[model samples]
Target: MPPAATTNLGYTPPDGGWGWAVVLGAFISIGFSYAFPKSLTIYFKEIQEYFSISYSEIAWVSSVMLASMYAGGPVSSVLVNRYGSRPVVLVGGVMVSAAMVLASFGTTIMHLYLCIGVIGGLGLAFNLQPALTIIGTYFHVKRPLANGLAMTGSPVVLSTLAPLNQFLFDSFGWRGSFLLLGSIVLNCCVAGALMRPVRKTVQLKPNTEPQEIVETAIVDSRGQLSNVQTDKRKTESQAWLHKFVDVSLFRHRGFLIYLVGNVVMFFGFFAPVVFLAPYAKHQGFDEYSAAYLLSIFALVDMFIRPATGFIGNTKWIRPRIQYFFSFAVAYSGVCHLLCPLAPGYVGLVVYAVFFGLAFGMVSALLFEVLMDLVGAHRFSSAVGLVTIIECGPVLLGPPLSGALVDIFGDYKYMYYACGVFMLVPGIFFFIMHYYNYKKLDEEQRQSLAVEMKTSEEAEQLKTSSDDETDGRTH
Candidate 1:
């Protein structure tokens, strides 16, 4: 037989039931974590003018915030492993609210970076990782759909907040807007309170179940004998950090593939959205009209995210979902590459619709694909590891794209860069997934052949023993 699998404390999750409730909580947390940064772009232009900063310098506000969120992934993961999701999320909510409130009083650019970027970003990290991790614990068969539904929070919040931020900026200016945004973010705490932890009874293997024993004794590798009662407990030799972070995932082939693809993918992911508003203004659309484009993108995204999830969960799609994700990425890239062709208000509206569809498809599938590759059991550690590694790309992507804007004095080149970044990774994923699937199939067949041979051997031995016993009796 193949080597026995490692023993772990098993909790066979209920797959549904209260899982829907957890999804609701995830929606709220994830919505804020992603949308908050994007929505803050509304303040970027005014803030840039007020502080006499360049586009790239103002871009760093979101960049620093996103980087901190990604960098804090491991810490967030460790805390979730120790304390669970509710407390982490609640604390994250408080930090975000306080950060926004503090940011409103800022007199210098550094203050905004420290308050909204670092502290607020760290708070968002706490909210984000745990919410995603707990979903793995709560659902298995329905996980893709669950993830999709939860992720719709991004579009819904984005659509609402895009216009809301603009209105706040117009009515009360950026200062009052920041203060109000703080109060709005505090509702994440209320959402966290709803993420009640689920407890399931541990399952025991048949061979390891309690049984009668006689003359209980144990022998060590050194040939030393000891009373079984005293030596019954097995010791784990893994380091403390390994227990929490699961560093071995670095060696997992599928995880490595996912990680590399995601790193490249993120290098262009947020740049287009970050510049979308400014690009419109550069084209002479008024502020409300520019903000309206985001709402349009978000409205389509809101519907598509859930639909994509449902589609992904179907048997035909789930088996080949990696390819689906690859296609989504490529489609998004193609949209960006062709964006320059679109002219005037109608052209931009069409671009927003298509962009929304493509963006939503990728976002809905992102975590679902990761969980499929790494599995629910290891997903917490996997997400933590992924976020930290991906920080470099996530942090630098927008600012680098902004620099391209500064160089060309137009947004078209920035879109071109993002297109290439996304397309290359999409193609890479498709090819790698093809080979990986073939290897997995071969391994499964080999395992099945071994099981069949072992079964036949046992049957033959039993028949021979029965014949011998009959002969002896005769």
Candidate 2:
């Protein structure tokens, strides 16, 4: 818990101080957490050849890694709840590094699956949730920009790791590459070291008598609850669930809208990234040039994420950021739909640039919007719940896209299918949020009117009472 400076004290997020350091920490941990799986796909070809495995089987390595990461959200949240983000992130760095080292000595596919897929994935889960959870503690007013900067880690890391993985594989082969990659990710421990615990202080406003106050016991890492609740009838089951994550967000309308839309959107989200290189290869580009498309995408994505955050933070957009997020998703869908029209490497480069822009917009604003709906206090639980539910689509999206390619015997059809998948959810969010916003506005106005009416009635009663007392005294 944070201490007080003066009696007028409240632990307001010193939104800029050491918080920036925490953001940097989040950047590194989150970067490796997200980018590692995608960049590591560079070794899939060699690993396939060595293991003599088929395409589908090799693909499971990444799919399982992602699924495990997503599925472990609750577990990560539980650990973060019991401990703190610093210790959790530190332990996660060690766990992921160990998983990689263990994977290096694997003789069988199952060994890699156990070591990298489950263990490494859970390790990433630990890194990812803690990083995200810590950001809310340290910022409120500048949260959009803060989240924007933090999410930029994905593109920066992807671009760096793509080429690095290629060079590593060329120099040292798959086994050695995995071993070295383990050492490379120990940098997450350095990030963890920067996660200084936040101490919360409650600001008490003087009143005629003692009054109920709301406060968060721990403000830095996992802000589970802040509001003082008088209702103590919570069941044991609900209390147990709340110990790790708030299950009450399921009843929240805005969270429901965000969750359903995201579940739909993700069906098409990752598939394009997965198939981009293969699509380029199918279009007659060599392997290096084909792989370079990701670098192009990441480069553009890197700049756009921070830019999008800046845009979302502006007065005009920040109030209604959901619409902005919806537009970004729609833009990515349109990019995919038009990708088939690109003829060659130059055209593909243009497609990559636009796709990266749209992807960055969505990624930067994704959790920001969720936090907007549920607020920082419940964000810890909301995230875990959302990811656990999203695991199916995230895991299956790329494979489904691959199946589409197999069915059509052309990559263009897969692109078209993914475009539809994205566009529909984009439209869904736009429509649903439009009504949701209107409903919220109406409710706010009604509540204001009720408060005013009650105040006016109270004033009238006091005035009459004074008049009666004066008449009796006369």
Candidate 3:
């Protein structure tokens, strides 16, 4: 058991200090975690040509990578919980670097799947969960801002690596590019090194008199509760896999709402981006110009995330961040719905700007809102659960959208489908969250009433005992 301290009521965090440094580390880690897969597209054309594979088959490389990243989330979470964030993130960095280097030697698509998809994806999963978890440990008052800064890594890395990958591919071919990229990815190890464990001093409140106060002990990692404490221990323990991530999150009301909404939302989320360049190319734009569209989108997305985080950190917005996220999701859907109406390149540019904004807003707040709902104690498990469940949509969204194009030979219908898919979840989340807030308020009120009643009853008993002692003395 850990040593106890006096608990203080109504404590507010100072919100800034070394926490900002931690956010910087998170920025690098999260940037690579999100951007690596998307940036690899610079090699896709070359890969397809070299292997003489179809576009759909080549796309599976990224699809498998993304699916494995999400699928491996629980394993990463369990490791983070057991060993702390530093070691897990460092190990993950090594894994990603090694995967890239090994992929340089791949002779078949299957080899790429094994090295780049499975190994690299798992490395990213390790980076992602620990980075997000550590931010919660370091900052509460400025958490939104910190989260915003960290999440900006996605767009920043995408914008930087896309062109860099192009340069590498131009200079050395795919194999050489992979070798160099492996070295570049090793910077994640430097980021991981900066993620030192936070040491916190927790204070407990003292009793008024000399009565024994039974404190129920709970151990936390950083500031978050360890997963073992959250789960009920059995006399004879179950297997490690079942114990790793708490599957019971499926039954949690808030988690269920979040899960259902996200599952639906993801179907539309990535598909637009996947087809954005291809869609532009289909409309007679040159390859370079088409690729520039993604760079434009990513640059805009990079700027928007930090700006949204600042807004979310504001007094007016921070408390109600879930609503903001829901609005963003709905807004994205609206953008997709409007994409089919754009007649030319200029119109596509306009759509890209709005799309960038909506996407940035959603991505910035996605995990922030989850942490808000579940609290830090359950964040690791919650993230694990969310990612594992969302794997299907993440893997399927693009292919399914591609099929729409195959059917109609136009990208507009696919955009429309994605728009509706995104919009419905936004609406569902808005309604469900409103209800959830109401239920939560009611529960809080009831709990307060019960606490007050219990306190009053104890006071009465003490007064009666004092009176009886006085009577006996008289």
Candidate 4:
């Protein structure tokens, strides 16, 4: 029989030296995983013209890629659980690099779908889940700060990649640019190498009975248990998928509230950004000015993410991050709702600034909130479940909004729809979270009462025993 496992309920974090390095590694891996897909838009227009496809048709490239990235989450989670982050991430880096290199040779749009959309996306899924998982393993006390720093990778990479992609396209065209990007993406492998396992030492009790000696095992962050157990209690636990991902989260009051609100919020979340440049052109702005709007957004977004991360990591904000996230979502909705009121270039620029801040705040908090709810051990699975469910909104969002444009011949309605979608979720989150906090407080109070009662009874018993012994001796 294996040794009994040591269950540390409230784990104190280790010291900071190597852990910060791990954060830096995560920063690189996560940045590439997220930013690579968005940057590929530089090639989209060229590909569309080459293939003689409509806007919707070309948009499928991004849609399929995003869907595949989300859909591949389970596979990545399972693999990360089975193996470890280091090897899984290394394999992911190779996969995405190979996908991009092969995609450069594609003669048809189908080839791009298979290579870039599916294979490259799977690679990103691998990079993303493991990187996020490792951060949790290494830091607990400073988790918010770690998450904030790691998430900054997105905007930072985006700011760099957008222009780099453009420069590459200008210099080498789509095919050559892909080849170059493939080489650059291989840096993920190096980042993966830095995610070494956190080694822990376990001490055994001295002079234990031989019978009490049991097999010893170690469990890692991914929930792979190593130790053996004798006389283990049998209980009905959820199945593997449910255990890892907690599909039961749907039944959880807090998770349900978050899920419903997010579903509505996402419908409008990405669409405005998708149409922002086109809307600028529709207002008779020059093409360069319209394109520069994205640059402005990206620049502001890049700075805002790290700043928000720092803010979210604060003592006041970290414990109540859900509220912060809710506010950010609502704020984003307000920005979008006010977008149509932007009568000219200056108005649009103002809108872009607010939109950038809102987007950054939400993005930084998105997965962090999920991890806070489900825990780091189950985060991979949770993300997988959330992303797959969210795939529908992500894929349908831009197109549905575009259809609204087709119908009304104006973008205001789309903006309004998005605004309401975002606003409602924020409000739902605020109310639901208030209730959740109250319930948790009540539970904590009950727990404290029970503990105090038990302690008092033990103290009284000890006093009685001492008095009885003294009287008998006298």
Candidate 5:
């Protein structure tokens, strides 16, 4: 019936119990993964002085860290698929902790780059994808809520760490702060510990798991090919790559649309946040007032994520969560485009409120919608592949937005550019996903028709054979 619904590992998810604990673990891992990079900026000014480097050079530390994390997605996905989330996240905890501890003793900017940027970033990458991927494995029905709750970790951690880093820097200095941070990050290992494998406790269901998309690569069609051994080796290598990467997802229409939309969406995604404080100062607001805008945005964002998740999981919205996600992106774009028109600090606060809601809504639904499109079974590969491609935008988007400011000598154009970046993709998602849903319905109906015809033909064949047997007996 219905061409075999794909379930996770032939068992319905527990959807509660240990899954909630796993969400807690994911919350820690994801919180650190996203927050640590932004929070690290607090050390940049002092570190710039310590290393005798330019502001631009100091900035590369954050850039390298973010880039490495995104680039590490494929490797992280492979490990999670092979060994499960617990080991990978635990190792990630150790690696990042080690990175911070080592950075505390570094003698040069290069060492900080290596330890904090590359090593620490990859460790965060390890923490991020596995944590996000595991939630999909453990809950299908409540996944949006789980994801929403898990995503709240980013803003919550960022809000906490921003102020904590300031205090740490004042008390312990950068080196001592790094040392304390190393210890603080040990919580991720505890989080990983909570992520005990789910399958051991889950009750086994019926034996009709859907076929895996990852399969052996097709052999060359010609039997008499001149280099048969070489062809065989090539095929085997392709098969191995397929096992880890799910290259077949390239052919999945919904996955393709989601991936491409994300790529375009991210280019504008974080730019506004980066410039929010600066934009306020440019408009004649005091520095403290400008900083308060970020606090407002983060505060609103923290609440909206869980709310968005709960809404996404509802019966009516769940089927159309993709639309909700698209609208969020478009709404964020509109908020930025209209920012220049705001009257004063009051107007800016209003913009912050709406932008935070839009941003939180998109972040909460991002992975949930991906899993919805590809099924929980294939989400590891789907997310891994998407993040790796998304690295380029996430890394460069802010710099490009800054360039608009450098050229225009005003912030509004940068906001305008970011808005356009988001709006176009939002529209694309709306149109393409609409068509994808339509095609899916048509395909389902055709499949049912074929099933019914085959059933009728089988019944007729059985009846005719029984009549012939009866006549022969007479």
Candidate 6:
């Protein structure tokens, strides 16, 4: 294919229609990617007994899995950028299935860590980055809604997997459960197959035009067109590095703001969820009752995500989405901060309702804000870069929260810390985003002024030449 044709193939997104099918695929892949680790908690007690391990050691299984998933972001991003989402996700599905099958036969904690933690985590990384990235390719106007629907996969899968895992544990034991889970996870491959690559076309206007003009268009894939020049000085090493990671994102003001806020936000994010069941159990609830709390949270979360998405897509919110996201983060923080004050089961349930709403709203807008900041073309790289750095806090958050629990001999202090962590970042994002918005407006006005001046000069020069030609003819 010609260069123009190839460049054009990547320019425009369908924004809807079959894009909904792509959203369905993302929902499946992302659902499994996030839900699997949490669901595996049901097997931890058995695994601990079998391995004769401490709670901390057993806990490392999920921690390592999450860490590896975040750490593998760049590699997955590179693969997705190079080849596309379908193939990478298919391979990820296979890897996750294989990892689970292998874990079913493992004899040691180390074996589980290697199979379920590292390998499985990498597989999820592959599943996650592409699923998020492809949505940006398929939709723009309705993207928030698409993202909201796709993110509901987390709650839906968590709700299903939690109970399914318990039943499987009762029926078949942990080993047999792992085997069955492996089969179930292979459905990600089916979802991957559904993620049809969205091809866009950007056509270049004829060279006879005064300056190069580009337009987003649709054309036959095989059509021939002219070549566009690109920087040729970069060597093999630079090309490879740039292909996978866009290091320049470090300089991006909005992206930096988002990244810092997320790093802080994540420190509090997963820990609360991790400790929720244990906290409820500590409060003298039975295992079933404690687990039911998560169900309530997930159920509320499921409805709110789509609603948040619809609200975000509106003219009122989409333009100021960063503020909306900040509010969600702060809302979650306040809920956690007051969690300790909850009188009893009813209070916790009330807290769960608010937490679910806050969590859903944040999750729905998280990537949308990133996409808004960086645009689609750079979002893949931006996410990859973001995940790699954010992995530290994600890995440490639970342990640090656990230490607070150890110190206080209660979960309340940990909850307090998480609330602070989230709140600070929420406020930071709000203030910084306001300044960023003002700066962006100023920059746009300055650029417009420069363009107007250049156009006027060009017009005046052309008119002077026309008058001189008429005088010579006279």
The list of candidate 2 runs beyond 4 A from truth reads: 1-11, 201-236, 453-474
11-96 per-residue lDDT for model 4 (tens digits):
43452667788888788899998888888988899989988887667767777877788788878888877887899899999999
The digit string of per-residue lDDT tens for model 2 on 245-269 reads 8878888999999999999899999
Residues 1-474, model 5: lDDT tens digits: 011235655567777888999999999999999999999999999999988999889988998899999989999989988898999999999999999999999999999899999999999999999899889778877888999999999999999999999999999999999999999998999999999887745455565332447775656676545467688899999999988888899999999999898998899999999899999999999999999999999999999999999988888788778889889888888888898898999999999999999899998988889988988878888888988999999999989989999999999999999999999999999999899989999999999898788768777877899999999999
Error of 4 at 247 (Å): 3.5
Could you give the C-alpha RMSD of every candidate to the true structure, in order shown? 5.4, 7.4, 6.8, 7.6, 4.2, 7.5
Give the lDDT of residue 335 in candidate 5: 89
Q: How close is candidate 3 to the true structure, as a TM-score?
A: 0.90
Clashes of each: 0, 4, 7, 4, 0, 3
| Candidate 1 ranges with C-alpha deviation above 4 Å | 1-11, 45-55, 167-176, 201-237, 282-289, 458-474
For model 5, state the Cα shift of residue 62 in Å.
1.2
For each candidate in turn, the TM-score is: 0.86, 0.88, 0.90, 0.87, 0.92, 0.91
lDDT (0 to 1) per candidate: 0.88, 0.87, 0.86, 0.82, 0.90, 0.89
Model 6 Cα lDDT, one tens digit per residue, 216-261? 5645344322211122334555777888788889999999999989
Local error of candidate 5 at residue 386 (angstroms): 0.9
- Model 3 ranges off by over 4 Å: 1-14, 208-243
lDDT (Cα) of model 5: 0.90
Residue 54 error for model 6, in Å? 1.8
Q: Which stretches of candidate 5 lie over 4 Å from their true place?
A: 1-9, 200-236
Which 10 consecutive positions of candidate 3 have the poorest summed lDDT?
A: 1-10
Clashing pairs in 1: none
Best of the two (3, 5) by TM-score = 5
